[model samples]
Target: MKRFQKAAGQWLPKMAKLRGVTAAVVASVALSGCGVVNHMVYKTTGDVLQGFSRNHTVPYLLNTDDLAMGCAMSEATTPLLMSFGRVTNEPDQIAVMLYLSAAGCADEQAREHELTGLAALGDMDGDAAEDAMIRQKRAHALAAKRYFRSWQHHNAYYGEPGTGECPDFDDDLDEFIYMAGLLSGLQALNAEIQSTSAIGVPKNVGSMVGRATSCLDNEKWWGAPMALRATIWAMIPGAMPEGENAFERLEMSDRQGEQAGVRLSHVFHAISAMNKGDNERLRDVIRRHAESIEETPSNEDWAFVDAMSTQLIVAISDRMWVENNGHRTPLGQLGTFWDDEQEDVETMDLDDLL
Candidate 1:
C-alpha cells in the first residue's frame, strides 16, 4: 500500500505541472495570433471598401462662383486673388500644425492672404490705386493659391494613400483652378471695360462676362440655358418641383438638352460647395435630390451616381477649414446656406464615384 501511494503522488504532481505548462503555451499562441487575425480583417475589408481607382477629371457643371469658394468670395474675385501666387510648401505639416493650434486649416491661409492682400492692394482707403500695389496684391494671391493647392493635395493623400493604396487626387480642386483662371480672365476684361482707353476692349470680353454673370443669376426652371439649370438642379434637387424627382422630371420633360443642362448645374454647385468646406449643406442638398430618382433594380447607373456623390462628399470634406468664416458661414448659428437652402437630396458612394 505504501508503494502504491508513492507512485500515485508522484504521477499526480507531474501531470498537474504538465497541464499548467500546456495552458501557458496555448495562451501565448492565441495572443500572438490575435494580431495576425486583425491584420487579415483589415486587409480584406478596409482595402476592399476603398479600392476605387483615382478619378482625376474635373466635374463638368460647376460654374466659376462654385469653383472660387476655396479662393475668393465670388467667381469675380478669384482672379483678383490668383493674380497673387499660391502657397505650396510642407502643406500637410502646415495643415496639421494649424489644426493643432486651433487656427483653422492651412488651405484657407492662401484665401485669407489673397483677400487681405487684395484689401491691402487697392488700399481701399488709398487716394488712388497704384500699379505697384495691384501687382503686389496679385503676387500675394498667387502665393496663397499655391499653398492652398498643396494643402489640398497633401490632405487627400493623407486620408487614402497612407494605406499603401490608390492615388486620390481631387477633381474639385482642378475645377476650382480652372474656374479661377476663367474668372481672372474675366476680371481683366472687366478692367479693360472700365479703364483701358488706348484701344477698345474686345467685344468678346464684354459678351463673356455678360454670359457668365447671366449663368450665375438665372433661376428660372424652363427659360435659362437648360444646361445651367439642369446642372444646378442636379446638385441641389431641392430646387426642383417640390414633390417630384428632379431627374425624373428632367427625364419626363423629355428635353434631353435641358436635362443635360440641369445635370451640369448640379455638378458645378457640388464642386463649388466642396471647395468652400460646406459639408452640411452639401450633404443636405444631395440627400434631397437623391430621394426623387428611381434607383434601378439591375444594371443601375450606380457608377455615375456613386462617382458624383463621392466627389461631392470628398470636396466638401477636403476643404472643411473654409466653412467656419464670417462670409461663408451659414445664416443661422445652425444654418447651411447664406441666403436659401440651395441643394438637393441625392447621395453617391465614395467607392464607385467617377
Candidate 2:
C-alpha cells in the first residue's frame, strides 16, 4: 500500500520543479495500470513525494542550474525568494500527502489517519462539523501577511516615493509583489470569515463565490486583492459602510495579468465551496485548478510559478477530498505550517543592504 503525507506552507520557484525526469516518472506511475506492478510504482511515487520534507529546516542552496533558470535577479531579492521558498515549502509538503491519498494512491489506513487529523484540528471538541475554521484562517492569514511584508521589501522598485532604500528592491520583484497581494487578500478574507457568527457554515460563502467568479469572468487579475476584501466585508453581514474601499482601489490598479487572476479565481472557488458546505464543489474546483496549471513553452519563469502554485493547491485541497469521502482528520480540515520563528530569538538585520 502507498503511504501519503501532507505538504505545509507556500511553494517557491526553486522547489517548484522536481526535475523533469521526476515529474515524468510521477505522471507515468499515475497513468499506469492499477495492479501489483502499478502498485509498486505508486509506492515509489509516495516515497518521493514524502521525501521533500525530510530536511525542511535547513537553508536551501540554489544550484548553478537554478541560477541559470533566472532565480537571481538581485542580491536583496534573491534571499527573500529563498526565504519564501522555505516558508511555503513546509505546508506544501503536507498538502502533497493529502493529494496522494485523495487520488486513491494512498492506503486505506493512511486515508483514515488523514481524516482524523483534519477533524481534530477543525472540529473543536469533536463536533460534527469544523468550528475552528475561522481560527485556522487567521493563522494562515498571518503567515501570508508576513510573507507579503517581506515581498514588499523586495519590491522596493514599486514602493512609493520617500520610502528609503528597499533592501530587496528590484525590477523583477513585481511578480513576487503580485503573488503576495493575492495571499494577503486571502488572509484578510479569512479574518473576516472568522469574525462571523454563522458557526461552522456561513451564507456568505455563496457571496464570496459570486464575487470571486465575477472577478474571474471579468478577467480582472489585479482587482482580486479588493475582491477578497469585498468578500470579507460581505461575510461580516450587515456591517454598514464596509471599511477600507478595497473594491475601488483594486479596480484602480492597472497591473492585471492572466496567471495571477487564474490562480486567485481558482482559490476563491475552492474556499467559497468549503464555506458553503459543498464539498463536491470544492473537489471540482481542486480538479479544475490542477488541470489548468500549464507549463508555458516561451516563459520558463511563468511555468515555474504555475507549477509551484499547482503543487501548493494539490497539497492544500487534498484534505478536502478526504473529508468529502467521509474521512475527517485535523490534518484534512486545516492546512497548517510550522513556524520556526516562534521558537528562535535571532533577529535578521537589513542595514548593510541599504
Candidate 3:
C-alpha cells in the first residue's frame, strides 16, 4: 500500500500537465475556428454589398434626375460603402462616381461663396468680401481633394491614365466610368487652381487627360472627348496642336453635344469661355443650353447625365445673374438676362373689355 501511494503521487503531476496541454490545444483550435468563420462572414457581406451597389444602386442613381438627392446620397453613403474595401476588393468604379458627386456639392458651395464675395465687393464691404473669399477657397480645396480621390480610384480601376492604351472596357458602363475618371482628373486640377493652393493634384493632369481622351471615340461619346481635349488646349499655353483652333473645335463639339441630347460639351465650352473672360460667349453658351434642354428631350438612358449638365449650366447662369443683378436666375427663366430687351406684347385696355 505504501509503494502504491508513492507511485500515484509520482504520476499525478504528469496527468495534470497532460490535461492542461490538451485543454490549451482545444481552446486554440476553437479560437482559430471562430476566426475563420468571422473572416468568411465579413468577406461574404462585403461581396454582397459591393455587388448590389454596383449592379442596382448605381444604375438606379444614374437614371434619376435629382442631383441634390444624388449629392446627399453620395455624402451620406460614401464612407459606409467604402468601408467594404477592408474585406473585399475596393469598388473603385463606384468610388469614382461617389467622389465625383461629392466634389460637385463642394464645387457648388464654392461657387455660392464666390458669388457672395462678388456681392460684398459690390457693396464695398471689404471684410465681408474677404471672409467670403476665404470660405470659397476652403470649399474649393475640399472639392479638389474629393476630385483627386476620384482620380485615384479611376487609376486603380483603369490602371492609370495616359498609359498609351485604353482599358478593355467590359461594357458601355465601363466606358462611362472611364470618362468620369478623366473628368475627375480635370476637375481636380481646375479646383486646385481655383483654390490657389497646392492640393497635391498632379500638375500634369491636364496634359494626361488630353491624351487619354484619344482612347474614347469622339462621335460616339457625343464629342465630349474632343471637347475635353480642346478645353485643355485652350487652358494650357502651347498645348494645342499646331494649326488647330481650340475655339472652332469647341463650337463643333457643342453642336454635337446639343444634337446628342447629352450637352456635356456645353459645360466645357462655358468653362473655356469663362476662363478667357469672354462673358458674351459664356452667356451664349448658357442660353443655348437652356434652349437645347427645352428643344431636345434628354436621352432616356442618359437622362441623369443630361440633368447634371443642366445643373452645371444653371450654376453658371446663377453666377452671371448674381454678378449683374445681385440675384440668381429666376425660376423657369434661365435663358433670359437682366439686360435682355423686353418683348413687345399686344395689350388690350381694360376699358375696351368693359
User: In every candidate, how many clashes are there?
Assistant: 51, 34, 0
> Candidate 1's residue-wise lDDT over 208-304, tens digit each?
3223323222332222233333334444424444664434433333232133233223334444344346666455544433432223211122233
Q: How does each model score on lDDT?
A: 0.36, 0.38, 0.91
| Candidate 1 local lDDT, residue 290 | 40
* C-alpha RMSD of candidate 2: 28.1
Off by over 4 Å in 2: 1-116, 119-172, 175-182, 185-262, 294-299, 326-354
Least lDDT summed over 10 consecutive residues: which range in candidate 3?
297-306
Which candidate leads the pack in lDDT?
Answer: 3
Per-residue lDDT of model 2, residues 1-354, tens digit only: 122222322333335665766899977877774555666665555454334332331112211123212222222233333333332332232222222212221122233344455666554555533434444443433433333333233223233211333223233333333334334333433433433422232233334333332223233333444444444543454521545552343233212323442344445445545555776655555655544443222123333333333444555465654444434223433232221134557887899778
Per-model TM against the reference:
0.26, 0.35, 0.94
Which ranges in model 1 have alpha carbons more than 4 Å from their true place?
53-105, 117-354
Q: Candidate 3 lDDT, tens digit per residue, 38-92?
A: 9889889988987888778878888888888988999999999899888788989
Quote the lDDT for 139 in model 3: 99
